[model samples]
Target: DLKMLYSAYAMEVLSDGHLNDDKLAALNQLRNIFGLAKYEAEAIITDVKARVFQTY
Candidate 1:
């Protein structure tokens, strides 16, 4: 459930097709809040980036 929430939030943040440092930092904070490991957070960000790229 928390992962889902984090994913959704990540998608929202990435909707603009950009992941600037500020946004990355914000996502990191979210990742920490969700108790996700660093690798897990990277995986989630990578997945979201792939999905976004597919649409572009």
Candidate 2:
């Protein structure tokens, strides 16, 4: 189950790597690819940014 989730998440990341798409569209694609049923890119990015900044 963990591996399956990770694979789905990896696919999401791959699909989102291109910045040509708007954030909403990219996040929706990610949500669909991951079977997440919802878009939460803002929250995720906020948490990730906080963590990254903390590391500095």
Candidate 3:
């Protein structure tokens, strides 16, 4: 459930299909709020980025 929450926030952050520094900072802030470790967040972020950037 927590991962889902993070994923959702990540989705919004990457909505434009880009992960700029500001977005990264915002995601990092949210990551801290969710109490997820860097490694965990990295994994989820990676997956979300891939999905968000995926081309049909």
For every model shown, the clashing-pair count is 0, 0, 0
For residues 2-28, write the lDDT of model 1, one tens digit per residue.
877888999999988998999999999
Q: lDDT at 28 for candidate 1? A: 92
| Regions of model 1 farther than 4 Å from truth | none
Q: Cα lDDT for residue 12, model 2?
A: 49
Of the pair 1 and 3, which is ahead by TM-score?
Answer: 1
Return whichever of 1 and 2 wins on TM-score.
1
In order of appearance, the predictions have TM-scores of 0.92, 0.37, 0.87
Best by TM-score: 1
What would the TM-score be for candidate 1 when compared with the true structure?
0.92
Candidate 3 residues lying further than 4 Å off, grouped into runs, are: none
Indicate the residue-level lDDT of 32 in model 1.
86
Q: Candidate 2, clashing residue pairs?
A: none
Candidates 1 and 3: which is better by lDDT?
A: 1
Q: Candidate 2: how many backbone clashes?
A: 0
